[model samples]
Target: MATEVYRESFERRTKTVRYLRFLEGLADTQVGPIYLGMWGALAFFSYLLCVFITAIGFGEQVGYNPIRFLRELPVLTLYPPPPSAGLRMAPLQEGGYWQLATLFLSLTLVFWTIRIWTRAVANGLRPMVPIAFSAALFLYAAIYIIHPIWVNSWNEAPPHGLRGILLWTNHFSVKYGNFYYNPFHMVSIFGLLGSTLILAMHGATILATLAYGAHREIDEIEKSDEGTHRAQLLWRWVMGFNATAYSIHQWALGFATLTAVAGAIGVLLSGPVEPDWFQWACRADIVSGLQKACVP
Candidate 1:
């Protein structure tokens, strides 16, 4: 009996290893190409979305967004008297609040997803329809990469005054926002959007893929096929949920894109942006390269 149990355990271990190896092989072949343009596009689109959100949500006063919090805190500063006599500049429109609020919310959502979505994916009840999954994959991955890059840009800023420091901390000015020299521009903004884009596409491509697959699964069931029907149904539900999430993700991306573009435009016209210190990382501005790898 002991010998038999040991043999069974060994066999199961061998099977598990083989399964992993098979999956790894498939991923290398199928998923490798997917990464090529997916990351770069993801970054560009998502960054745009973030900028749009920050601009409109916070209103034109988007520049002083961080000041609100800073002013309320322990720091004391001399209050400048309002424009003396008729010198008032059209009350600088201020509206970056919502953008900042949403950023926090989005961060929280990602945190919860790690706790919740990660577990769900791990449980094997994978619902993502292929196309939706692909698009969403593009969006979120970009968001993640951009966040860090943007933050680092702020910290690594060339020496400037307190105003510059404050502006860097918040989206006071995208040109001065510190991410002007992003290495991201070099790689091509293809797939950097990651999960955010994937989630957005989930509603359409993902939903369609799920519906088609589910309908076929149900048909198989009606034909008296057994065992896999329940699994198919579960997968169908997963796809639907993903579609719902993607819808929200797309909404966020749309918002972010508009915000970022507006910010980029404002800064570009205002003055010189960051000097490209890492020009080597910037891809050669070659037409062939653009056609071949940067087309997306």
Candidate 2:
């Protein structure tokens, strides 16, 4: 009985040591439970705060009925209270909840970006994920924070709703003499549409070759597999060039990143830098015969 007790105690110690070693290895990876847990908690709290604020806005605007809230969701807008509200806590209808929700959402984004960067570096991978994500984050900041500061009015920021966003976009374009003439905006459109096209091509190529036992098309491409080879040749014939399995992803990432980068630039330049995109285009000689429309 003494020997059996000693064996059980030894086994327990061994298991504990193994668990500690596992945790140590995870920590070394820079994406351990602690990092993930903090990120998850921040994200969850941000989401909940936003939901709570939206619920309150909906209840105040369209009664407490869930069905009514759902029906009116498309038209409901949560306008941020005036700057007089300041950083101090105010009533829910006076933008206190919006401020809290925005604060937590910003924190969530910062932590999420850090998590992506640290995890990528620890794994000896390129910083593409974080870089692309940061560009998107910049666009969000440009709309909600940077541009608002530049214009000296928080009201410049769009309200939190579907129709509200559309209304904001319309107001922006009308006030600034049309956004289509903005070169950065044009580039963003190209980037977004080009990324979609690239994704569809890549997905279709993989699916098309799946029937020929080319499920692992990326690996098979190097082995000169018939299905992958044919797919590549088909694209080369159609487009005069083709991306390799590895290069295709890089191409997609480039376009996707360009979309946000261009959008952020355009947003930053809208009011302070140029004020009117149509006039800028006319001055740059990109458009003609619309001088009358370009009048300020």
Top TM-score hit: 2
Per-prediction RMSD in angstroms? 18.8, 9.3
Task: Write one digit per residue (lDDT tens) for candidate 1, span 1-296.
Answer: 55568656766655333234566744522222122133334444555565554344333333446675355333312111122312222222221233233344345444433434444465575533333333343344333223323443212221122453364435423433234334343222323354356545443443455534433433443543232344334446777532232254555555445344433333332223343312312343433333443323
TM-score of each: 0.25, 0.80
**Residue runs of model 2 more than 4 Å from their true location after superposition:** 1-36, 83-92, 118-125
Clashing pairs in 2: none
Candidate 2 local lDDT, residue 209: 81
RMSD of 2: 9.3
Q: Give the per-residue lDDT digits (tens) of candidate 2, residues 1-296.
A: 55568656766655333234555744532221343556656676776777787778768888788888889889988876576754345576877656665666677788788778877887799988998899889988988778877877766777788898899889878787789998999999999999999999998998888866466554565676467787888899999988887799999999998999898899889988999888899888778777676555
The global C-alpha lDDT for each of the candidates, from Candidate 1 onward, is 0.37, 0.78
Q: Supply candidate 2's per-residue lDDT for 241.
A: 89
List, in order, the clash count of every candidate structure. Answer: 58, 0
